[model samples]
Target: MRRLLPRNSLRSRLLGDLWKPLFCLLLLGAVAVFFLARHIGSSVYDRWLYDSAMTLAEQVRVEDGKAVLDLPKQAVEMFEWDQVDRIFSDVRSRRYGLIFRNSDLPPPPEELQPGQSRIFPHWVKGHAARVVAVAVPNPADPADVLVIQVAETMLKRNTLATDILVLVVPVLVVLALLVGIVVWRAVATGVRAVDQVVERLDSYGPDRLLPVGEITNAPAEVRPLLNAINQLIRRLSDLQDTQRRFIANAAHQLRTPLATLQVQTERALREPDAARHGQALSRVLKAVTRSRHLAHQLLMLARSEQSGEKALQMQEVDLAVLARDELERWIDSALQQHVDIGYDGPESGVEVYGEPVLLRELIGNLVDNAIRYGSVRDDGRRGGAVTLRLQVQPIMLVVEDDGPGIPPSERTLVLERFYRRRGAGGQGCGLGLSIAREIAQRHGARLVITDPPQGMGARVEIRFAR
Candidate 1:
């Protein structure tokens, strides 16, 4: 179920998390203050009641072993007089039932002793009162003791309690307000810092893909997010630089073929002799074919670059079967160039996981490169042999030719786009080996260029991990 009130903002979540415990703390503090005020009010009034009971005790005396009051009626009336509370008093002896009394009050305990006092709440004439009870020894008879109790109505205590609440509650509320303000300012400052980072991102364009610099006064908690954003910007900037260079190189490579095609078309259209026109047309067809192959290779290279984002359409492909089929397809083209082509592996059962179309492209590029470059010798002879060898144990594909082998120093260089060897003898652009290497990598295989073990020729091997 969805939340009734979802906390969507960082500021609100932070404040909510912090203020829950803060609110509880304030509530407890208020409760403590209320009880403290009540205690203070009670303590102040209880002292007055105790003193009154003690004064009444002093006025008592023992006459002929009987406890009596030597106080006058006016004195009693004056002692009990108050503006806010009604006062009540009683004097009694253990030996005698009662000695003197003013009004009905709750009596002290039966086991009362001299010089001890207790204060508590009681009802005086159906009104709430606070009572203080004291006991005194009779002077004439040490065995006899008198108990005295004094109580007053609750008016003065209630007024003191109300005054205490009035004085304290506002101070507590102001303190809570100050704390809330501080918390709100802190949350707002942090949120503003994050908003500033967002604003900086919004201001960026494709031409200005710069990193977000460190923000001043940003909290330490935000440092990791800034670092991640800067890293992403750096990657995007690097990718843009690579794309620009790729476009420039691709355009440069296609220019010669297009110019040749244009010239051949113009010549074919202008020639008067049928034979010369037919020859010009053939050259134009060859130029168009070369241009088409170059464009297809460039598209393949772009696809390889973008294929990282997609899941491979993987299937169990027989490596030996794939190589034999590719070799068969290229044999006619090889014979036309006077280069013998053969396969040296099992007809089937050498299986690996890869996309079939991409695998075919990989093998085609390798075989095409072998036919174009491996058929020519240093002396320009056009008869040589190319072999496709596959190993089932380690799952490898090796394409080797009996021609001038690439030098060790130039092996890695040839894998880079458009990196032809210094004395290379082929009409092929340098994307063949690089595209083969890209496809090999995507299939969890490694492509390496080396010389044949028993002959001096270029040998390219793709080793798939078992």
Candidate 2:
């Protein structure tokens, strides 16, 4: 029943909802009213029948050893007082036959012998009637009895029913209608708050991200929806801020390399000596490589952010095998930096669900950043070991580098693109940690940076919930 109603209009759905119960009450009330009226009418008419019979019995007297009658025509005519009703009377004596009766009146089923009388309903000249029969003692002879019966048509009973229903039905109907009106008005008033909310949302735009004023007065039933809508607006505002920051950072990082490339090309054109020209060309090539790396990192960041919207194309793969594979790709770079980097885990069977290529890129970014910024020791010595440890306990991955460890204050800051800390000198565009964080989040994993137990290097742990 609830599912059948459309959600758009509350008033139409609930209006006249009271009618169902009212209608059922009316059905039950109809039976009750009918029986009650019939009982009242039958009581009144049955009493009148017995009174007329008793009166007729009074006139049946025995005088001088014989039963005699002195019944007035006026007494009989009074029984037919209603124009719509017909009346009948009969009198019999123990020693005599019928003394008086309407010729068309139907006889009682049993003979009214002396000292026997009863009251019952029987048809009279094709019309329904109530009858009363009684035995009366003779005034002179107590042994002998006179029988008297009287019947009357049911005009007064019919009139009573018509009058009662005409009065009762309207009062109930008016009460039902009034109650329905009151409920309808109350429903419409209560839902006015929701209508105000709809009007506010109808004109909403991206610039208006604040909570709606109308919500404070809204009914409690709709508060959850209002709060949820406000939360959506806040999320959209945060997304807008992130996009602006990303664009500004990308532009700033690209400018320096591009300007350096332009200057180096001009210097190369001005130099006539082949060796110096070759040196200038080399500088220009380095600038181009830096610019290319920055652009690629920007693309990776964009892809990771959108991974939430685009469903992950996943497959089960061995994390140990994937990390080792990426480790091999970075070996040459680690050697160039004199960084002793290696995989320290099993060869296979650390399985997880992920996009293979993206997972590989996530590992490569973390390892590459370690080799670039993590090759120096705290004592300012170069060529230190950076280990990639994949542990099966709790399904975790840890990357530790014996380099100048990140300061506690800058640990979280480094995860933001282009956010570098004090004395953090490197060739990085500050997107390596950011890219790794995004990829890990996409895989339903948590990434935390902490100092290793030895307290001399930074440790990054990626933990996946089981």
Candidate 2 C-alpha error for residue 347, in Å? 3.2
RMSD in angstroms, all models?
5.3, 5.8
Scored against the true structure, residue 120 in model 1 reaches a CA lDDT of: 81
Candidate 1 residue pairs in backbone clash: none
In model 2, the worst 10-residue window by lDDT is: 1-10
| Angstrom error at residue 318, model 2 | 4.9
The residue-by-residue lDDT of candidate 2 on 320-397, one tens digit each, is 999999999988888987899978889999999988988898888989888877886545556887899999977888
Query: What is the TM-score of each predicted model, taking all chains together?
Result: 0.77, 0.72
Error of 2 at 15 (Å): 1.3
Taking the tens digit of each residue's C-alpha lDDT, what string does model 1 give over 264-321?
9999999999999999999999998889888988888877765543578899988778
> Model 1, 136: alpha-carbon shift in Å?
6.3
lDDT per prediction? Answer: 0.84, 0.79
Per-residue lDDT value at 237 in model 1 = 79
Number of clashing residue pairs in every model? 0, 0
